[model samples]
Target: METLPIVPDAAVGAARHIDEYAAAGARYVTTGQQGAANTQRAYAGDWRRFTAWCREHGRESLPADVLTVAAFVTALAEAGKKVATIQRHCAALSKAHQLAGLPTPTDDRQLKTLLEGISREKGVRQKQAPAFTLAYFKRVLQGIDVERLDGVRDRALLLLGLAGAFRRDELASLDLAHLRFDEDGLVVELPRSKTNQKGEAEEKAVFFSPDRRSCPVRAVKDWLAVLEQHGRTSGPLFLSFHKGQRLSRRRLSTFSLNEIVQLRLGAPYTAHSLRASFVTIAKLNGADDAEVMNQTKHKTTDMIRRYTRLDNVRQHNAAQKLGL
Candidate 1:
């Protein structure tokens, strides 16, 4: 029988150290659960793409050099990726490198200059989601049969989403316990949101409309009555149902919220359209930047102005007021 050579203690120790380092790097990559689910998924995908590119080019991805990063970004630009998307990919790669105890290439002046050049060459015009205006909302209401359980739930969702300028994820994450009803209207306590990532509690008030048909508060009450009839006094504000119409304890997902809007409008409106529509409609109806921001919870006036400017192009144009 052939005798196997014994491995040295130093070689064994080095192998163990390599294994521990790899394990730690992997743990660092996946340990943090910060940000929204969508954001996390996007970052993961971006990092995977970067790693794949590095493997293809025989470069070290964790400690990516500045030239490699610049080339990667340039390739992305050549492939017609949006400037924002390229920037996000860079952020993901930098974060991964940082977590893995490697130096990030993001601070390199050459990489920064390349990104700036790409941004200038590509132009940074983001496509905005179309707004679902009040007129369109009224039309949707006319088609709904509120007598049905689904209709009742949809009406409440639509009104609340519109009036509160809520993101789809925010609406889907709501619980019955977070809502308070009074003579004035309804108050919703949001535990966490995209803006409030630290899980800070934020309160949003939705007032009653004079018209019962258009009143968000009344619509919520109606939905709650149905829930009460079903003996559902707790858990998610919106629940899923079986084909037999029996309610399940499962909360509605954000994707479902998007589907609800698209089905109601019979158009390509997304869940974000509700929030954008609130801003656009508010601006069109003479609401100032401060007023719009108060409801939308926008951190900066610049974003509010973007929505207002689109609506104001025709309605509030200074050139239109002047006779040529």
Candidate 2:
């Protein structure tokens, strides 16, 4: 019945002492490398929520019973949790059970049926981030004072995010080493993204605009000069600033990036708007799905279509052209 006595290696190995046996058991239970930092954090948080709920309701969280999981998810739905959120909670529960070497109750018919009912009732369509107009974005740029350090940095940040159609995390993770410049434009080396996790390197090109005031290439060059002055030629591309606007060496968090977007671009826009708007604006201006996908790095046209894919249904609706 002992954990140590059951393990195949610890059973026959000469290191049969309790200490060595315990060490061997510990090694097997070490952290899983199944996902990115964000995913791990999400799972950890979800597990905590599950454990807390169990404590309140007199149910077991780990090696959880099917009825209890079904009940918990039902409660989540009653409490108005999104279908996506409920599904993630189930995934977290499964992950926890798998790591602990237990048969996950999520696979049981009761839980499965409960989730399907929840999905059918709630519908699985995710709410997309609101995208703003390119004209509005340009007006925002005109208002910024590029002469100031923060202005210079923020302008570069917004432009690169738009032109590259970068995901929020990708935009935040940019490093000096990821960039290469030539006469025509800047080439950004994307080693990893949510879609491309194999670490296969991909390149995105941002060309110079004849309009100097709104050029992504020029804005980035200016921000790099600021970085050079601060002796930060490598590491995270964006940084947090001190109280007096003195630059802090610490890299900006994704939350801070969203705050920046909300602060400068108005409250309706989140960091996702940069990418969504890029897709929307490009498609509206006659870029085909393939052309939009090229900038967005989307593996398929479906996601591109979704962003065609709308703040207002009227703006990008296919019906606009029906002369009827």
Candidate 3:
């Protein structure tokens, strides 16, 4: 065997340092623990699109110059992307540069001005998800046969989602271990959520209604009984059935929750509509902002106010008290 030249100690040290640096950079760029899975996926797609666009234009994507970022935002605006989407794209680029240990060009005055201009040129108003009012919820419940396994699961899912003011992903994340039952109702412990990404568990209470037909607590108990019969005592709280008949061990996805809402209501309502409806109904029923926030887990009063648009107008109407 031919003897190879021995590597110098200094050179070896430098090589090891470089390897460590590269590993740290990789962790910074690829770690998915910072945000929700959906957010991480969206950011990844946005970054890929930005890099592809840069390659096509013969420009650098990582550590992109201020002018390049400004032009990219302008192009996105021209492409009819919503202002919020463009902003998210910008944020994705910023995060990429940050991970690479480069200063973000998005913070440049020129890029900031360009983004503001884009927002002004293309309206900043986002299309709100339609609220599934209590009345509409009752009508949907009337159609479901609570005696069946699927019906029991869906009733429980829908009622808990609305009464607990749960996001679709939060509802889907629930497991048998997360629930606690009592005479009053059930308390669900959310280990992680969109807002509570740090895994600091938050508990939401769902009270039993006087009427069994619309009671979330009773609905959940009925579903639990069905689940127990299937010998599923400790998996997902809500599961998907095979062929709409036999229960499967699979957990329901957030998309399925949205589809469930739309199919039940026979309308375009999304899963978020349940959360919005909870806030809206609470406010309309004279629950204060803090009270609404408690159930919705909203951190800001501004968000609560926005969700209660009709209630706000009614409560503060100048003409109503003026007897005009």
Q: Tell me the tens digit of each residue's lDDT in model 3 across 1-324.
A: 121122243443244433443333334444633777787777777776776666566565545789888888888988999999999888777776676657889889878888888888888988887776688789899899876788888888889998999989999989999999998899999899878888896899999999898999999999999989989999899899998589999999998888988877766688888888888878767788988888888899999877764634555455775766
**What clash count goes with each model?**
0, 2, 0
Best by TM-score: 3
Summing lDDT over every window of 10 consecutive residues in candidate 2, give the lowest-scoring window.
1-10
Residue 102 lDDT (model 1): 62
lDDT of 2 by residue, 1-324 (tens): 222233243233233333342343333333452555576567666766666666566555545788888888998999999999999888877766666677889999867888999999999999878888888999999989877788888899999999999888888888889999999999999988877778887989999999998899999999999999999988988998998779998888889998988888998888998999899889878899989888888888887887764556776577978989
Which stretch of 10 consecutive residues in model 3 shows the poorest summed lDDT?
1-10
lDDT of 2 at 232: 92
For model 3, how big is the CA root-mean-square deviation? 7.0
Candidate 3 segments exceeding 4 Å error: 1-33, 309-324
Q: Once model 2 is optimally superposed onto the true structure by TM-score, how far is the C-alpha of residue 163 displaced, in angstroms?
A: 0.7
Error of 2 at 216 (Å): 0.5
